[model samples]
Target chain A: MHTAEVLASRLGLDIAVAELERLFSQPGADPPDYGLDGGHRRPIRVAYQGVRGSYCHEAATTSFPSAAAVEAFPSGFWMEDAFSTLESGSADRAIIPAENSLDGPIDRNLDLLLRHPAVRITGELVVPVNHCLLAAPGVEISDLRRIVSHPQALGHCERRLQSLDLEVEEVDDAAEAARAVAEDRIRDTAVIGSRIAAKEFGLRIMEQSIHDEGGNYNRFLQLGVGDGPLYCGENRKTTVAFSLEKGVSGLFRALWVFESRGIRVTKVDHRPNRANPVRLVNRAGGVELAQMDYVFVVDVEGSELDPRVAAAVAGLGEFSGFVRVLGSYACTCGA
Target chain B: MHTAEVLASRLGLDIAVAELERLFSQPGADPPDYGLDGGHRRPIRVAYQGVRGSYCHEAATTSFPSAAAVEAFPSGFWMEDAFSTLESGSADRAIIPAENSLDGPIDRNLDLLLRHPAVRITGELVVPVNHCLLAAPGVEISDLRRIVSHPQALGHCERRLQSLDLEVEEVDDAAEAARAVAEDRIRDTAVIGSRIAAKEFGLRIMEQSIHDEGGNYNRFLQLGVGDGPLYCGENRKTTVAFSLEKGVSGLFRALWVFESRGIRVTKVDHRPNRANPVRLVNRAGGVELAQMDYVFVVDVEGSELDPRVAAAVAGLGEFSGFVRVLGSYACTCGA
Candidate 1:
């Protein structure tokens, strides 16, 4: 009867009418299967840090067209491996969670961008962070004794899980938890992961979107291995990381370069220059030493071709840490 | 005989030495409550979001030299009221959780910062997050029918809480749970909050840190009405929020303002821009229109007085949505 139901029926997309009710019961909620969009243009081999049906995987599907062959990694550390796959002749691109709507920035991802100067911000995909309580086929709610998932997933599902009165367990990832259930590690075990994982792994959706805080979305970055596509009519975004030298006013002098140069910084963020700490002196003549890690990210609106932007960064003296230029790309989704 | 016993006596302060080891121990892998710096600070008026002896009050006492008055706010929002009071002639300053190392950023507090731009960041404090299952004086875990606390607090104690095998209820805060027992609202109900709440409100510590994740420390922000000590020494830090206008290209443009200016950023993070959504446009077409609201939070190496820092920001132009100079206090502790 619903338009989405008709679309689902025609597309042969495995969308259940009842499941749609659960995820979209709230007003303004969109259907899970965004169906196929001409926007993606081509098939994208997305590299995420988890197994199939994970939230990352779901996000990748939304960002790309036909994620037929997904390359998976065990931890975030392997994202570079995936990125390398994109860089070399293996994969097309990678999908990495730059930040979470609920949890702030994923620090490791930020560190990865800083450490690996090659990856550039091509485009971003925002995915709703909806998680569900899943159980294997034939199992019912009464059969569940323990619930497992990533810690945050567990946190999100706490209220619903508590209502079920099941034992809670912590796992490395939601997909892994589902995998555990598939292997029949414990008949009473259930996992809090994506509904897609539930469907892929043949787990029933016991519950969904248990997070008390609504409007959860994850901003994912699409990284191009090489110099990305030039901007046309599309919106654009650029990302970079830099830092200052150490001294009585070293950092102060460093910042003055930007203001003097006449550049508008859209985003400026930092991560400990994992490389080093700085020495600081206090009023009490207390000398405390710390290897200062450099601040690593900055973004803005404009073209690198702008002479002012180029001259500004050059003016800063010897940066004690890294100063990198990531990349600039056109935003595909036109607002 | 023990370190706490010796320290309590030496401090010349009224420190109620509880058996922390015994107090924090659990039946199978309960969390540890590495006693915080509380019970050591010089007496002062420390405001908290709960009744006397609440965990926050405990944190406040530890923060000061000798806390003379432990002011209790009904909720965290009231703590904001208290911060306003400190500004409008009531309290001096207040410490609030910005993030938990284990759980993640205290998003609510960050949201608060976005609203109350006047609050300045004084310094950062680290407090070990400990969640305990508490019961009334005469009751035990087995007699408990329901466990209650703020949602995240309950999640931290999820595993231990699951093990208790009791029903769960949601409450406003930890001390409220303690107050539940103190007021005799639920005779057999168990509260999962802080150990300080148990002792302060005369409840029993049924179990310790229920959170499965062990490395838990909440990052507390000391906020005041106006400018704090400007020069944060070695570990000196600054917090500011900004936004970008359209047509941003190359992160270099953004970084040029900072890197060229010599002002180093320590952390760069993104928040949803509630006012303006990130515009996405494709050459042909892709996803529909969207406007995202976001705020960029940055931590610099020094005070705003740093000329380079000011110039860089000036260059940042209209791309910056807002600029709130948090504070210029140096960290007394070595990074």
Candidate 2:
């Protein structure tokens, strides 16, 4: 029997092997209206964390091309402010980078997702990151005595930066660094940022794609008001966060629920539960052991509307102490 | 039946309930000599990332009190340099923060562990982070107009700083920020750092424990040369990193191997496989789909010396494309 057939029989679902193959192969169909009203009434306002030329700005504009305006929050350090703006109805949508291919998850945003329960993921956008070395006009790379960029950007281009033998300064944002270089007209310094930043600050791109590795990408998420719209598509992803009631077996059982239904789990991230950071496990003698409590964020390849997916989530209640479905969104990577 | 009895029976291990209770209750037994030879021949040299009064420095000195010298790399951005210092035999051991109770994992160090295969973890240390607000000797808290510290430190004290209404400047390290504040004699600026930093720079503590949450802690890992020694203790943690050969089911199977062996998984972290960031899944008729490949780092509560652990790791070979046991260290969290 085919793998899907076995799964279907076990789950008592009538899904066919061909259907499963198609669902697994596609990169998510076009999503339904997600609270923007198809942009018919007015252009959607999107809030992003960074200056006008930062990567987040690029992601926002790229993902929502017809957005009325992409407002900037001061820095990545203040991502909460962006979420707050969206929650306050100042912005119809908010965009934030969920993870970078090289740097991994932007953790603060993940924490914010849990903190801001009213926000939901509406879509995903994958942007290829190409770091550019920008300097004042007519300033060559050899004339640079120092380099400045966000710490993560500097870290990404560490190998190339080391070879250049220049002093490195860490800044809050890459675009901000570009702005500083342009405003100061520092002949002895270059900044590592994006091409958009270079253009925005009227700086020359001395070198392009200076990062050490190729294929660097940042995955950005579009967020809207709670449960704005259900994404009805064959290729979909449902993100959920849950904490176990007790014991290590709970995690295994939780994963088993999805696995038994042939649901493909795309990603799993564990964060220390802020409210209950540590749990004291007590034995019969009252001796206590401290164990770190965790909030698990999992992404599985199925819409919440799917019968098998719904059944699996229901099954999770048996093992999970608390569960929250963050969103069921189209898997619109590279779109 | 007791939980241990049920677990032992399921796993076919002869461990007793009382013994299991002891194992589960203790932090970890005093670790065996881990190739330091009791520091008899020469004072053990330790390498850490950051300046003298940085948190990593405190963790190093606190964890290795008998070390002859604790050397500092430039900053956290140069953590790989610390690892390289260890790999090149310039340092006997290196210590780096693995995770913060609030900020989550120090991702670059986790990536370094996978990149540098020779460095093995020897022990773990937990340090309570009490961020102090320090200023010029005569400066009062009300006199401050700006705050300078590491980004993470600023983040930890965000709530307090917001109420103070001070401008925040993010530097690479908290100690570095303190140094700048002292050297520049910036009376208007206060820095958030450790008490050690304030003392090192001749600054006065304007406020103590200014972080938003009370139980802020950083978990540090003591790394030594490859396979230095086996930690024989009732409470132990074995960390391993692996990537699957094929489908998502492999991860489920990998976890099942440990769950079946009655080993409790304490932590699980996922990162993109650098060499193979994305895999192309192909079906019939040349239909292809791109999937992000991941490197999973997991910590299980058992030393590699245990037969059950050995069997579980052996079982991983059946499902994993690549696997490496990073370390089997004593679970000495508080110590």
lDDT of each: 0.56, 0.71
Give the per-residue Cα lDDT of candidate 1 at B236: 54
lDDT of 2 by residue, B1-335 (tens): 67965654534321221222232224343322333233323334577776777888777666544333234333344778778888887776677878887667777777888988898877776667878998878998778888988888888888998899989899877788788888888899998998878877899998899998655778888787766646456557899888988845367778878988898776777887887776665544444544567898888988899999999999898778888998887644443
Where in model 2 is the C-alpha error above 4 Å? Answer: A1-40, A64-78, A130-214, A247-249, A282-289, B1-40, B64-77, B130-214, B247-249, B282-289
Give the best candidate by TM-score: 2
lDDT of 1 by residue, B1-335 (tens): 58986776445322211111111111112223324455453322334544554566655545542223333332344556556655564544566655554334444565567777777766665556677777787786667788788887777677777777788888876687687687774677887777767767887776676677544555556566565335423455566666666423323345446765667765555666645444443333343433344666666766566777767667775466565555654443211
Residue range A1-335, candidate 2, lDDT tens digits:
67965654534311221222232224343222323232223334567776777888766655543333233333344778778877887776677777877667777776888988998876666656778999999998778899988998998898999899899999877787788788988899898888778877899998888888655777877777756546456457888888888844367677878988998776778787777666655544444545567788888887888898899888897778788888787544443
Which residue window of length 10 is worst by lDDT in model 1 chain B? B18-27
- Candidate 1, residue A268: the lDDT equals 52
| Per-model tally of clashing residue pairs | 75, 0
Residue pairs in collision within model 2: none
Angstrom error of the Cα, residue A145, model 2: value is: 10
